[model samples]
Structure formats: C-alpha cells, structure tokens
Target: MKFQQPLRNWGGSLVILCLLLYLTLGANSLEPLLGPLAPENAPAIYARNSFIDLVGWHLLLVLIAISAAAVIAILAALFVSRPVGADFLPLARSLANLGQTLPPVAVLALAVPAVGFGSWPTLIALFLYGLLPIFENTLAGLGSVPTTVKDAARGLGMSPLQRFWQVELPLALPLIITGIRLSVIISIGTATIGSTVAAKGLGEVIIAGILTDNLAFVLHGGLIVALMAMLLDGLFVKLERRFATV
Candidate 1:
C-alpha cells in the first residue's frame, strides 16, 4: 500500500488546502476575477456579506448533487461491470450513447413534471447525465484487465472473487477515478441548474443577475462554481497520479 500512501496524503492535503482557500475567499471575497462582491442593501450589510452565504450554499448543493451521482455511479459500475456475457456490452454502450445525447436541461424538464421541481429532480437529472462516463469507464477498465494477470490468478487457484479483488480491481482503480473526476466536474457545473427548481445553488446568483441585469452577480456565481470544479479536478488528478503504478 506504499504506492497508495502518496495518493491518500495528497488527496487529503489538497482538499484541506482548497477548503482553506475557500474559507479565505468566503471571509474576504479574494478573487478579483469575479469583479466586486457588490454592496448589500442594508446599513449593517457589508459589501461582501452575501458572498458568504453564496459560497457556502453553493458548495452544499454541489456536495449533495455529487453524492447522489456517486451512488448512481457505484451501483452502475457494480452491475454493469460484472461478467455478463459479451452480449451485454453493446447494450451498455447504446444506453450510454442515449444518455449522453439527451440534453441535461431536457432531462430536467421531463423530470420536473414527475418529480415536481426542486433539488430532487435536478439531482436525478444530473445523475442520469453522469451515468455514461462512469458506466463506460467501468466497462473499459474491467475489459482491459490483463489476460496474463487473470490467468496467473486462476493458475494459483484463486477464486474469481480473489482474482478480481486482488488484481483486476486494483488495476482498474485509475480508470474508475477518471470516471469519478468527470462525474464530479460535471455535477458541480450542472448543480447550478438546481436553482431553476428553487433549489439553492450558485445558479441563484446567475438567475438573479439575469433577472436584474447584474453582470457582477452572474460572474461572481459562475466564477465560484468554476473554481470549485477546478479544485476538485486537481484533487482527482493527484489521486490518480499517486495511485498510478510506478
């Protein structure tokens, strides 16, 4: 597990660092790329007062959405990657194709009727949209497990479970992480759409901006979402590198 140590260390450290950065920005509105934080409407309300709520709640929505997607992804990976005859692969591919082809907004629209607005529908739409990346990568990683390794495990009288756990899964971890990275980034961006349903997310800022023609609010919201996505992606990359076999 020595090879995994660096990944664990860096993954934890990077998240901590990003958290610190987020806290700093929350406290001070540090990033100038988003322009001024705008003056609050009251005497006691500081210029950046809303920034704290915006950043905090936006992050909360992202985590909630990502968690929903993760559950979908993990279940899909478990079910889809199993040794179903080669026949099942094409079905997975076709389904993934369809999933990706449907616009997320359309999915949200369709879901809104059934699920009836709010974060639940938004969460479901994002999870469905994310399914392709996770499913495809799981299939690819499982398929690409080396024949020699499989043979060696079998030759040693290892059970299928043992071989998969000890060899195939470990090797496939990087690809799985890649899929998760894609999913997380997409989730973060898509989360903003939740605001359409009156679900709080960074999208509120964008929606507010549009309603009032406030460019600064839009930029502020959009920039934070982008930063959060980039930060998470960097952490994933570090995890991938750390776990990558030397």
Candidate 2:
C-alpha cells in the first residue's frame, strides 16, 4: 500500500521530533563527551558529522554482509518453498537457531585469533549473527504462500522460475522485509563491537566515553546509533507495507 501523503508526512514529522529530542536532550547531556563544545564548535553538527563518517567508513562491509545474507535467504526460500525440498527444513531451522545461539562476541574473539583483528573478524561475526532472522523469515514467508496460488501459477504455464518470481516472491515480500529490517537493526548494534577491534564507527565514541567517564560523549554516540537504526527500520516497514499490498 502506498502510504498516504498524510501518513508519510507523519512519519517524517516523527523522525524530525526524534532528531530534535536527540539534539535538545541527548546533545546537552553529551557535554561530558566533548567537555562542552568550544565557542566555535557546534555539538549537533559535530555529532551528525561523526555519525555520517562512521556509517561511511563501514558502509562497504555492511553492504557485503547484507548482500550475502540476502542471496542466501533467497536461495533458501526458493529451495524450501517447494514440495520436493521438504528434507532441508530441519537443516535450515537448525542453522538459523545455531547462528543466534552462538554469541557474536565470542565468535569475534575466536575469529580474531585466525583472521586477526580490525573489521574482518567483526564483520564475519556480525554477518553470522544476522543470518538467522533473515534466513528463517525467508523460509517461513515462502512456506506460508498459499498452495492454490502455486497450483494456479503452474497451471497458467508459468515456469518454476517465473512463478517463483511473480507469485511466491510478491506474496512473501512483507515477511522478507521484516527479516531484513531485523537484520539491519541487529547489524547496527553489533557494529559497535567493531570499535573494540579498532574498526571505526559510533562505538569508538561510546568506548571512549566509557573509558573517560564522559557520559555526554557515550550517550551522544549511543543515541546517534539508536536513531539511525530506528530511521532505517521505519523506512523498511514502509516498504514492507507497500509490497504486502501489492
């Protein structure tokens, strides 16, 4: 469903309100991090710049993880969506559960020993942690497709590939978006852990804040990350609704 203009505007307004809150409350409290912005410095601008730079720095790796997960999810969904593919359901479920059961930090630590620090280990860990929600959702969404729809699509002379693309996928999109939204939000949270390995992100500011007892700084970094995740999730939800309506 195309979100009506009023609803879309309302979403935008809510985001603006959040930013304002972050600026007014979160920023003021953040004086601990920056030791009060200098006369020449603008705290809000500085925070915004830091958040943007942090995202820019890791954008490529995050994209890699997201792309990999999407590909795997698509394949898994297609496979499990078919009647003959029932045998793999147990394995898919196990994999999804196992991915989450393994602690990402522990995985990161183990990976560090082999891969050695920086972004690689962190990326791997985050990627693994992210697989479950997306993979499971993909499988579940596809499985939930009405059998009648599939039969009709097949009867209409649509090839397996064509039916999958046209029928199964469109019906499954909302669930897929929900999975992706969860993965993206989880990735945002996990990315902060990357700072421990000296990979740059908002986590660096947070870690610094913790080490220095700069409440303002830590809160500033954290608040920014939270806001970013919420914004992305909100956008994805809109997309989800639109696709579901189609």
Candidate 3:
C-alpha cells in the first residue's frame, strides 16, 4: 500500500515532465490546440530565441542570484545570532529586508543606470529579493535550538565551535533549507522579469505574447514556469520531510 503512492507520484512526475518538454521543445505542436487562443494572422509560437536557451538562462540567473544571497544572508544570520554580534541583529535584519522593501522594478531602474541592461540588473534585483527569508529563517532556526542542548554539549567538554557544529547546526538544517527553498522558488518567478530588459529568459516568451496579444505564447511560458516550480517545490518538500524525520 505504501509503495502505491510512490508509483503514483512517479507517474505524475513523468506526465509533468513530458508536458514541459512539449511546451519548451515542441511548442509548434501545440499550435492546433492553442490556435483559437492566438491572435488572428499571428504565429502561435515564440520564435525569437530557443526555449531551451531561455530556460537555461533563466536557471543560471536564479541560481547565481540566490546563491549569492544565501551566502550573505546565512553568514549575517550566523554572526548576529552569536553573543558578540547580538547587538547588530537589527542592522542585519534591516539589510536583509532592504531588497523586499523596494520593488524589483525599482531596483532594476536604479541598477540599470549603474550596471546597464542585460543580466546584471536582474541578478542584483534577485540577490536583494532573496536575502530576508534566508536570514530570518537561519536566525530563527539557530534560536530554536534548546538551551539544554547547548548545555549538554558543554557538559561533554565540547568547545563553543564544536557545540555549534556537532549539535546546533544539524537541528537547524531543515529550517535553513526551508529558507533556501523559498529563495529558489521566488528567484525563479522573479527571474522572468529580467527578459523585459533583454536578459533572455522564459519571460521573453510571455512578453512576446503580451506584445502580440497572443494568449497562447503567454500560456506556453507560464505553464513551463509553473510546472518547473511545482516539480522543484515537490523536491524541496521531500527534503524538508526527510530532514524533519531525522
């Protein structure tokens, strides 16, 4: 009976993956299915760039942005959680929220002037957007470790560094990963906007739809992002459950 669920999930995963492949690689095949939705006399497919390249660039941008954000956020959270750095927590928090406080468009506007168009502005915007959740989650995770656990580590003659590595970090990993999961998902959605400025991602397909009033193109791109997001969310959820069990 337990094995039945895994088999079902495996089947579902294959279906979603096949649909994703059709949308990204064989979009032309969808023309008949989507024909009525497209504007009259317009091509239903997004032909500016390969959808494969768009997906690749989209992933690259998100990965780089979130990776940079995670490093900074996790480090700041670690520092401020310690006794010596506790007083600086507010500062760290404010910095983490600085991205969320300003809309991505505003960041892009400000960044474009300094960094110019293309991926740089998009990367900066995503980096800023990813900071708050990671920092807050890591901080919360560290704080959730019981006082007795630390004492117990001390009781075992472990140093502060050893206590953190051997005891606290493992307990806190699930939440830290939760922060990463959130960041990764948010970055994926946000990276789409980078296309407006020629950053070249799935957003290009959506923008094309909007410009030509082709709902099919928009659906094409949206479905691809949505499916990929679902798949990734499922993967992270499994990770969260696995670690929670541990």
Candidate 4:
C-alpha cells in the first residue's frame, strides 16, 4: 500500500521523467517519427548541443535565478509587513514592480552589454522576471493573518519573532508557496529566450528550429519546457494544499 500510494503520488513526475529521458536520449532515434515534421533541407534533430545538456543547463540557470528571487522577495515582504519596516513598503513594492515591468528579453539585451553573453544574463533576466509574483504573494500571505490571531499569540507571551515563526508564517506559507510556483513557471518560460544570448537552454533547440524551419526541434524543446512547468506546478500545488491544511 505504501509503495502504491507513493507511485500514485508521483505518477505524473514519473511519466514526465520517462518522456524526457526518451526524448533526450533517443532524439536521433526519433528520425522516423520526426522526419516528416522537419522542413526541406532542415535536420530533424537539434544536434548542435545534446538536448539533455541544454535541458540540464536550462534547469540550473532557472534554479539559481528563482532561488535568488524567492529569497529576496520573501525577505522584502517580511520586512515590509513588520510595523517598524512599514514605512519602506512602497519602496519594496516599487522595486519588485520595476523588475516585472520590463520584458525579460529587454533585460537580457540590456544585461548582455554589461555582463556579456551566456548564463549570467539569463540568470539576471529570470531573477528580475520572477521577483514580482513571489514578493506580492508573500505580502498578501503575511497580510492575511488575522488581527485576532496576532493578539492571541501575544496573549500567550510570544515574542514578535516567535509569533511570526509559529503562527503568522505557518498561515502565510501556503500563499508564499503559491507565489513561488508562479515565479517558477514564469522563469521556465522566460528562460527559453536565454538561448538567444548564447546561454545554454532548451531555447537553443527552439531558436534553431525557428532559424532552420525545423518543426520537430521546436516541438521537442517546447514539450520539455511545458512538461517541466507542469511538473513543478503540480508539486507546488501539493505543497500549498499540505500547508493550508496545517
């Protein structure tokens, strides 16, 4: 029963992982299936870089970017939600808003001259693009805590920090997780554009397909990206529900 439950819980993850493995490891083997999808004179496979390597690098860049954005956003939200830090709320919101206001491609274009090409520019763009949703959701989660609950925590002689950790944060975690989910999905989609700057990612395949008119390459890259987003989103949804029940 335990094994069965676990299998059921991870069914989607397993399926996607299997598909990703088949697509990446057996891409060349797919010539029969994908041959018809390739435009005349264009290759059926994206062979410039191994699809697996591109997927790995893409995930790595996103992980780094989203981790940074989440930390900064959550901390900023925490500070601004505090009474002593209330005055800085507008500034914090404005900072987060500014990041989301600009398109990721623009950020990448502007960042390239400053940092040059490759993963760093992509990281910068993803970090900036991912900031707003997490920041806003954190703020909303903290704000949603009931005044009565705060009073109750204080009535128990808990310190502000203790109350936040034990009470407020627990209540707010679900929404914060939701924000992270949104940020993750956005970062995944935006990360595709990073390949334009010589950053390693699934975008390499998509961009190559566009340039060469290879529909197979485009579909292959887009499929992986979409699957990754769905998997992460499902995991986050589970976390959100788990925390909400607590």
Candidate 5:
C-alpha cells in the first residue's frame, strides 16, 4: 500500500507537470494549426486575460461550486438515509432528479436575471447540476451498510450517533467520495459554459473562439479543461482507494 501511494502520487504529479508545460510552452506553437491568425479574423488569443489567469480562475470557481454542492448533497443524504427521514427519500430523489433534468444552460439563463450575471449565476447552475449523483451515491453507500454490523455496534453499547459517526460514515466514505468525484468532473466540463454569463473561466476562451471563428482559443480552452478533469479524477481515485483500504 505504501508503495502504491507513491506511484499514484507520481502519476498525478507527472500529468500535472505535463499539462503545465503544454500550457506555458506548447500552446503557442499550436496556434497556427488551430486557426487563421489574421488581424481582422482572429480573436485576441485569450480576449481579456492570460492563460494562467483563465485556468486559475476557472478552477477556483469550479472548486467553490463543487464543494458547496458536495456539502449539500452529503447533508441531505445523511438526513434522508436515517429511519426518521426515510419517508422523504422519494421527494428528495425527485428534486435531485429535477436538478439533473433541467439543462445547465437553462438554469444559467434563468439564474442570470435573478442573480445578475457573472460567477454567481454560474455557481448556481453548477451547484444545481451537480447535486443528483452525489446525493444518490451517498444514499446508496449509507443504505448499503450491513445490518449485522449495526447490530454489533448496538450490542457493544454504542449510541446511534456513535455508530453513525464511527462506523457507518467510515464504511460509506468511499462511495460518497466517488459521488463527489463524479460531480466535480462533471462540473469541470460544464463550468466552461460559465464564460457565457461573464463569469471568468476557460469557457470564455472557447466561447470567444466560437464567436470569432478562432479555433486556437477553443482548442486551448478545451485542453486546459480536459487536463483539469483528468487531474482531478486521478486525485479522487487515489483518495477513494485510501479511504477504502482504511
């Protein structure tokens, strides 16, 4: 396990280093191939910001949105998985389903009028779009805990709260983390669209490219986002394995 940990860390680190090298040194070389660069035809490479700024802010927004969504999902799952709150599961599921079914663009469109554009609207959209998977996975994980194990905890004089905190949560953690991973990766891709609402993100680059027919901008943005998603997914896989082996 110790050996495996270093291997995983190295793998993730290598991917990140490669991505950074590309963003810093390789992106410029690909510009000619990605699109025409005439002054009249091309969009300014990044429009308003540097590549590092774009990637940094995009990731920051995504991190904030996904963290919020994960917290909400976990709390909701904890509440609804309990016997006292079991009856509300159907309602909770319905709401989470609704969040998924409504297109994120539509959510953004609706949110902008109320939230007045920018990161807030984007955050709202991502949070809503990310809820279902995490909620469902948390519910499944918590519900999957063996009854006998629970009974054993009771036999040992553990309180309900103690059992849940010490035993059930640890067992359920891997699945819950998986849910978070899914939600985060989904959010990473979806968040690129946030640029349309005047929120700062890689999506701005892609959208600018589309409007101006500059494929270089689009490719750069997509590459950054794809690398980010892969990096995060890899990290989460490591985290899930760590929790599972515990």
Candidate 6:
C-alpha cells in the first residue's frame, strides 16, 4: 500500500511536469504551422519578446502579485480573527468583498490615477481581488477549531500563544491553503487584464490578438495561463491532501 501510494504520487507529479513542459514548448513548436493563419497585413502576432521571455516575465509578475496578496490577506485575517479584533470582523469582510465586487478592469482604471500604470496598479487590483477568499477561509478554518480542543490545550497549561501556534494554526492550515490556492488560480486568469494597464503578462498577447484579430495569439496566451493555473492548483491539491493526512 505504501509503495503504491508513493508510486501514484510520483506518477501524478510526472504527468503534471510533462503537461507543463508541453504548455511551455508546444505553442512555439507549432508556431510555424499556425503562423500562416494570421492575416497577411496583420501586425506582428505578439509583442517583441520571445515566448520564453513573455511567459517567464508574466509568471514572475503574477507570482509577485499573488505572494503580496497572500501575505496581506493572511495577516489581516489573522488579526481580525483574534478576540481583540472580533468586533471589526464585519467591516473586514466588507472590505475584502469590495475587491471582488469591483471589476478588475475598473480597479485598474481607478488605480492608474494614483499608481500611474504598469505592473503596480495591476498588482494592487489582483491583491484586492484575492483578499476575500483567503480572508473568509482563514476565518472559517480558525473558527472551526473545536472549543473543547482549545480548552484542553488551556487545561494542559499551554499558553494562548503556544496553543495557537502548535494547535489552532496547524489545524486550520489546510483550509487556509485551500483559500490560497483558489486565490492564485483566480489571480492567474484575472492578471491577464493587466496588459490593459501597461503591465506585461500573457494578457498582452490576448489583447494584441484582439487588436489584430489574430486568434493564434489569443489561443497561445490563454493556453499558457490555463496550464499554469492547473499546475499550481495540482500542487496545492497535493499539499492539501498531505495536510489532511496530518
């Protein structure tokens, strides 16, 4: 059974890795066949960067944006979940929901006035849009920890801080990770719109395709982003399963 489980995990990992590789290389390999489809007078299919450059930099920006959102959301969730901040939970929830309530494009448009375009405004928009899920899940996970478990920890002479670190946080981790995973996937899709704000991401290709009426560019960009989201979500699923076993 143990051997079978490890083998299954290895197989899954290998499959995902191959899929990622195909997503990364397949479009470029097929470009020759697909390139001819573009209108004879169409502008260049995509911006000046090579495929690797486009995907690599776009991914980096996405990671940066999501990482920032995770940090901010987790910290804020932790704060509001505490007893001292309990009264402010409703307000926090509202603020978190506000991100999703506004369209990413509108967020970008509103932000550009202050941040003035490029990746910064896009980052801000993604960060805001990602907050609600993480915040809600964090709250749910932390709140779901049993009262009896907390009481037992207290009876065992564990300090509140110790109990939180060793017990509550560990128990809540899987759900928190789930929230992070969802936020990341959603961010990956939405980040494409960043191109409209002058940020470099896969969305640039999609937008360019729209401008030139080139479907190839749109397909390539969309495929890359979709594959990236699937890969990350798969990793997070493994992580969640591991946490579940614990």
> Tens digit of lDDT per residue, candidate 4, span 89-135?
98888777776777767877888898998888889888877888999
Tens-place lDDT per residue, model 6, 113-175, is 989979888888777777778887888888899999999999999998899899998998999
Greater TM-score among 4 and 6 belongs to 4
**Candidate 4 clashes between residue pairs 3 or more apart in a chain or in different chains:** none
Cα TM-score of candidate 4 = 0.90
Candidate 5: count of backbone clashes, pairs at least 3 residues apart or interchain: 0
Report the lDDT tens digits of candidate 2 across residue range 179-236: 9888887777777877898766778877876775656557667777766666666677
lDDT of 3 by residue, 121-156 (tens): 889888887887888889889999999988989999
- lDDT minimum window of 10 residues, candidate 4: 1-10
| Candidate 1 lDDT, 101-197, residue by residue in tens | 7777787777788888777777777777777787777667777888888898999999988987788878878887788788777777676877788
lDDT of residue 3 for candidate 6: 46
- The C-alpha local distance difference test score for the whole of candidate 2 amounts to 0.72
Candidates in order have lDDT scores of 0.69, 0.72, 0.83, 0.85, 0.81, 0.77
Summarize candidate 5's per-residue lDDT along 81-170 as a digit string, tens digits.
878888998999788777677776787788899889789988888888787889988988888899999999999999999999998999
Which candidate ranks first by lDDT, i.e. highest? 4
How well does candidate 6 match the true structure in TM-score terms?
A: 0.87
**lDDT value for candidate 4?**
0.85
When summed lDDT is taken over every stretch of 10 residues in candidate 1, the lowest stretch is 40-49
Query: How well does candidate 2 score on lDDT at residue 113?
Result: 84
TM-score between candidate 5 and the true structure: 0.86
What C-alpha RMSD separates each model from the true structure? 5.3, 5.1, 3.2, 4.0, 3.6, 3.8
